[model samples]
Target: MSPTVASTGRVPVTIGAMESSSAASGGSTRREATRQKLYEAAVTLIAEQGFSATTVDEIAERAGVAKGTVYYNFASKSVLFEELLRHGVGLLTASLREAAERTAAEGGNKVDALDAMIRAGLVFIDRYPAFTQLYVAELWRTNRTWQSTLMVVRQQAVAVVEDVLRDGVAAGEFSEEIDISLTASALVGMVLVAALDWKSFQAERSLDDVHAALSRLLQGRVSGCR
Candidate 1:
């Protein structure tokens, strides 16, 4: 999936939610908390300064941990970055999947599922703008060490939207001539760019305002007659 940008804040919403779920399930809560800190620090620092310009020492310092703690969690700065990308995107994929599944369970149609996923994407971006920005920037660069990892996670996220589009076509809810892959990519791109713009340029606007505008577009009301 395409990534975007925003300022870093507390632990990302999705990640924090995942951590809560994991903790309830008897998972390693402490480790996850530490990783969350590192992820937050890395995203902020790397987003502000390019990945190469950011160092393990700086990440550890920002995270309020020793440099050795960084090495303990990740073999090197590159490994830490690769895992950070995976972790953040993985949470995003889960959120999208949950939104789609929840919509289906509620007897919503394919369009509804897609719209729900759009909101999920916006929420994720709104929560972790710096991470989104970092992810998007890495996607444009072909030389990154984690480029392969990035591609895999990206496809995993986009595949959720693609699946919904395929279902829509199968059910005759969408035109068979429509390109599923491209349309899925387009929908994701729309939310990513729109949400980034909302966070960066139109910070005064509420999420509901952005979602309503995008929902209108999804419902084919672009002419504003409906």
Candidate 2:
């Protein structure tokens, strides 16, 4: 399982099982730090110029690590990006799962769980804008080497939303006519696009403001007028 952004502090191993290869506690910490740096560098470059344009050397330089360090941690740039996509999306999925579980534990309904998942998505995007941007851009494109791996990761995250929606439908909170899978995908898309828009084009709006807007839309309070 990939560690959360908060727990792992935003980065780690790829290209191989380098993260867990070290058994010494001190060495493991250092290795984890190096991997994090590399991930941070890779995500920024890939998000800016894209995976094809970004190189290992550039990632190493941006990470303040030697070229061999990149090789030491990851087998290749593709592996690095693959691990990155897995790790980032894994964190998002885990976050949503925890939020849903926590909400349910607190006697909240599936609608509340869904709301928590949406906010969790926003928070994840806010913390890892580069990863979110890269994923959003690449998600619809075809023929990429990493696309298949990413699809599985994408499904894991979306499944969290689908679970909550399914519960809502079963409990009569949501309409039986709702297509749970489609609605879940739409909700995930909504959070991703809204977060990117807020970060890229709508700097004046606060995160709270954006969240409120999304919450209203989810609660069916927004008018359908175009």
Candidate 3:
């Protein structure tokens, strides 16, 4: 006969493990949802009223969160804006990265990858015109904190572009002599200019037309054929 022992008072290991995992996942999901809502509110307010005129309280209200929640997630208005800028940049970068990955999977040329990246940027800017205005407004700001934060976010995109450009050069699809850093910055500037111009003069131009022209510009292509 097998000897039977009394059950311990502690919870079962399997049940305990499941409960912990569920609690952790639920907490993470809630945090992410809250953060997303806050980000959306911040973008909408900044776009509508410009960054300078927008207040943290307004963002909190718009997000349907207590003001303390905003402070809890972001230390200050500057930090909040920095996060917003990062989020916007992330959206564009992810779009570009996805396009690049897809092109690579199909064994497409580097120029195709680069063009897709540029087109992704154009699509993002066109979709977020007001955010573009806020971004440009921040360009002239003299605040040291803001400047540093912008530099950090700008570097993130620059690094991504540099990696892609380096790959293009390695594959012999792009000129090795081209300055990757300068070219990336120039490409970014062109996107900004085209997007701003299109939004500033909505009646005169459409985003699709601008994106087509800009894509060709980035590709160094013209009707005359090299």
Residues 1-226, model 2: lDDT tens digits: 3432223343342222234556565455667777877887788889999888888889888778899988898888898888888877877787889999999999998878888888888887777788889988888888988889988988898888888888888999888999988998889889888999998898678878888899999888898735
All candidates: TM-score: 0.87, 0.86, 0.74
**For model 1, how does the per-residue alpha-carbon lDDT over 135-188 read when each residue is reduced to its tens digit?**
877876787678899899899988998999999999999989999899888898
Please tell me which model should have the higher lDDT, number 1 or number 3: 1
Clash number for each model = 4, 0, 0
Please provide, for model 3 over 78-131, each residue's C-alpha lDDT reduced to its tens digit, 9 standing for 90 to 100.
888887776666666677788788888988888787777777777767666656
Candidate 2 off by > 4 Å? 1-27, 224-226
Taking all chains together, the TM-score of candidate 3 against the true structure is 0.74
Ranked by TM-score, top first: 1, 2, 3
Clashing pairs for model 1 are 1-154, 4-132, 4-133, 6-129
Deviating ranges (above 4 Å) for candidate 3 = 1-24, 28-31, 65-69, 139-142, 203-207, 222-226
Better of 1 and 3 by TM-score: 1
Q: lDDT per model, in order?
A: 0.83, 0.81, 0.71
